[model samples]
Target: MHLDKTPATRGLPRERPVLLAYLRWILLVTLVAVASACALSWALHHPSFESEIRVLVEPAEPRVGAAVAPDMETERQVAISGVVTAAAAQQVGVSATYLQEHASVTVPAASTVLVIQFDDTSAASAQRYAQAIADAYVDYRKGQAATLSAASMPTAATTPNYPVNGAAGLALGLIVGVGSALLRDRSDDRLRGPRDFVERTELPILATVPVRRRRWRRASLLPVLRDPSSTAGEAYRQVSGKVERAARQRRKLTTVTLFTSPSASDGVAHVAANTAIALAQSGHRVVLVECDVRVPRLAGLFDIPSGPGVARALVGRVPLNQALQASEVENLSLLPAGSPGPLGPGELFTFGAVGRLLSAIPADIDHVVVLTPPVLDAAETAVVAEHAHLLVLVAVIGATTRRDLEGAAAELSGGPSSLFGGVLLKAGRGGRAARRSQPLPAEWDDDMGPTAPEDDGVAEETPGTTAIDRRGRA
Candidate 1:
């Protein structure tokens, strides 16, 4: 039931997350394809060498008075005939069927010339087979007007074409890689990119907290207290400014801003902590209340002693004023959700307890930031709706999905308070599926309503209307 000890930090990831995960998937697939291609190309065929002989056929000159043409086609067929193959096999020390399979013959067009060729796995065997076949064909055609016009010569072994093989590999890799990348992009439920976030929610982002680069800065969640000039620190100050500006527009003397999330691990705790410190740094009297008693984090966050706070005040064990604690930061007070007894979720929020808690704060305080549990998981949101003037949602880019955010926004729509704005964490990488996944589908029933975010960030003016609407804030 305690929130302070829960330690899932969505700000940083252990490996490549979000958009980087998609890129890594593509790279891995492409590399495998290329390596396979290179290996197959080298092992595709064995070294081969070949020798060829040309035989010229001419009509007999003195056999008859009339002119005659030599039958080159018959001469070409004779080169790989059974008798010639049998004799060649004897000379080459191979079977007649093997010699026939390796031998080939062709007649040159418009010429009385026949070409004989042979191939073998080994370079020396290939040349020997070719010469033996050619010699045997010439011997078999001794009565004909055929002559060995060209001598047989062995050629060098052919080499594999590295460039052509490499090009083919590249083409195949790209096709597979691009196709895989597109398929992943579609199924991923996370915010796709910075543009995707704006298009999906349409809510005005109060602040975009960038990821931390240094280890120590990452270790300290309250960057505003440590280094207000840093990028992350400044973003929280911007959040405080937006909250104050929104409150001024409503003309409220004291603003109670509740920062909640759709899930337990959306970096909401860090955001709530730093924003209160940022407001304090700007010289505004701010009281940061940890109302998320189920998983109280403020005590562990500030290293403050955990006793006699919200839980005590809720049961009348201590005066509300006595439960408030002074923080190290000036102009800021911390009220941690201290040790709890048997109590229901609705106690602190009901019977005007919320109003009395607000009234108990010193009159000089400018703002009260309450850190509450996730909207979808907690029932107190409907009750605290009356106390919190401005409601800000904190969503993480890589760890929160579109479906979850929409559901929280819809549930919060039933509230009496105005939907002020939202905060985006880890804005650098998005639009990828990593730690976040789509919520389980709710069963179709009569009481179920449409669960989706409003394209227009305007809550309807009509009461009991269920939609996420930030009317003037858009």
Candidate 2:
């Protein structure tokens, strides 16, 4: 678990897409809402025209020796009273209830003025109602006047105002869209893309396997063997190339790479199996060892029996050769976990046992890919990590979390293993299990020597004789 010293950037370039994806959804929702509101407004909307009349009030001619004072409040109240409205409605040929609902009267502060406003569907009708109200108020005022008198007549009406503003609606929509996007980005904890993993862990990405939609009957555990010409097959080849490059950098003839994940169901088994097959197809002798004793799957993956595997050999019940089984692939062999004994995995995968197991591998084998239990779940994996020369971490794109990756790395670093790199699996749609027909590139073909002889499906053990051939042949 070698943590990269490179200052981990807060957000990598690749992670931009996650925010963008959220933004897209947010904008879509906002657009739909705005469109719906606009539609509703249009369907239920009623256009109304408004007219206003401002009239002046003055004190009546003062009596020769008597003082006369005018009260504007009283005049304003009288202008909008039921009596005036009823008279106005009768003159305008409309119901008093309608006039009361659509017309209002107010007085400008510190002035003897009454403002009468009318609203209707037609501009001419609004104007007529306003004039009628003014006339009715004046006639009533003349009858009751002792000091105050109506002075100025009503003025002409002004232009009507539109109720809805498109710019404001657009602005509100934008705000909602951006807020939703940010909220979603903040609340989501799952890793969205490769860039997020890169930024959080600062680990080199070995490969990215796309997400595949498969029919149940067509699905196979071994992608390299089942379908070799699809995108998934090509991805495995790329992983093999990376592994080979790492081996070359270390300058080791026999490289032991352990594949593990932060947790189970992260496709660690699938990656390990396919990688081994890919290396074998590249003309290298490869052995896939299943160390996940708790739940061994390599035997089922290769359709081989679980007996006489690594567990039997480790306990000295069977020799390494007796436990080794040939696979359907040309140069790959399987060493299953075999049946569990009374001892738990923690007790069985002791450092000494792992070292002995590694030392006993045939000298001619180019690569030994071991599939181990998830690091976070099994302490035994720490023991396995101590013996492995390189560690490969597999993580499902959307399923793995930053905490899981960090925890796994911390666990690996706590032991003796160094992180070689990481593999991003199930990245997006269009992933399938398949094999590629193209051969390794010339530069990457350093280990493209003669392949080991095929296994005859029988294990032989003899004194002073190696169980597996030095050239990786059974």
Candidate 3:
């Protein structure tokens, strides 16, 4: 069977990748948070302790016994008292009661210099304390020596010495804290922002969808219809509207294919299935076709048994009617590829049976969304794209690299003859998906005329609904 699939247009958003962008911001903040925490610990604890020294200077005068005066004697004594404290405590080490209590000073007989020492939790604090003591003692001895030299009589003095201690623990803690933050920042591997997309490939992001906390399943498909105000619902409606507008210029309904890159999370298939359901709920007759023969997920998504599906029908053993199963939503259907087996559905992609089965579907369906295999792995997606009216390639924001996207786009560009268009998927508020979409070439828009950037910011808005040519894009 020979099926001629025409090119169809669909609006994809090009707005700021708010979610991916936020992720990058969060990553940067995380790095900063870790740094700040370490700084706090260093500031609050005393890692080093220091002590000070006290010096007493007395002058001696020779007693004069001379010429006949029996005895003349004089004596002098001086006493000094003070306490030692760490110098520039805030700059090098934190102050603590324990460090101050343990500091002591020792003075020896006829010693001009008094030695003081301190114990600090950290080595750096200890070093700093030692340096401060040395500087202070040097100054103290100079003043004492000068005074004693000028005195002609001998004197005795007693002084209470204060001990100095160094800050050691505080310095070590600071280093450890900063180092830990740096290491954590280095090891982080989560997707950061849109810049990551270009790092891997040069492909343009066509559309970006935000992240949703809710699980996506075909059974409960009322959110898009019930709550148009919610972000998820709005996204669903917005995507559906964009698809409709893109196809408005074409005579036949568009066949949009969704495919993740090889490394994409399992979220891509979920996006495609739910997106199709949302379109069907909004009055379009949508059929979700399972094109991922290698790792089929449609049956599991809908909770259906994989029997007489695309694989069976393609081989001509089952009719399309038996293989297609109606979903919970009205006017929506699922064409599963069936369960995993040795039949090698991936092999069936090259055979002509797959084409005939797809073509056999009725033309009344408003849209057909296919969850194809990863572009980098299976040829089935490219094979399926051959018979599709338009290829809507799905890409997760940060997961798919720019190089991979570029390669995918290049692979799809078998010329205008090959039905292909780009659709960026899994783009959330802040993530790799949040960047503005790359501009389409002039030729891609020549036939469609001016289309507006959809509310999401990718597809340009056409002046009026009638502005669409309804014959497919040029």
Best by lDDT: 2
TM-scores of the candidates are: 0.76, 0.68, 0.54
Candidate 2 or 3, higher lDDT? 2
Every candidate's CA RMSD:
11.0, 9.6, 15.3
What tens-digit string does per-residue lDDT give for candidate 3 at 118-146? 55554444545544444443344354322
Best TM-score goes to which candidate?
A: 1
lDDT of each: 0.67, 0.69, 0.49
TM-score, prediction 3: 0.54
Candidate 2: stretches off by over 4 Å: 1-13, 17-19, 28-79, 88-98, 105-173, 214-221, 249-253, 431-474
lDDT of 1 by residue, 1-474 (tens): 001112223342344443465666667777777777777877996655566767666665666587577677777777778898999899878999998887778887898877777766666777677777767876886765444754455566554545676678778887888787778767767743334454555556677777542232233467787766777888899999988776667654567788998876666667888999888887889999877767666776776776677766655567767888888889889888775555656655563565556666766677888888888788876566556777888787666777888887777655667666678776332222333333222211111221121121111111121111221111
What tens-digit string does per-residue lDDT give for candidate 2 at 1-474? Answer: 243435454543444543466666767866776676666665665666777777767665565866455687877777778998999988989888788888888878787677878877777788788888888887887733321332222343232222243444556777777787778667766665566666666677777776464332224445677877767777788889988877776665687789999987676777899999999999999999989877777766666777667665665566777778898898898898876566667766776666666667878788999989899999878888877777888887666777888888777766655677788775332453222111112211122111222221322222243322232221
lDDT of 1: 0.67
Off by over 4 Å in 3: 1-53, 59-191, 194-207, 212-229, 253-256, 398-407, 414-474
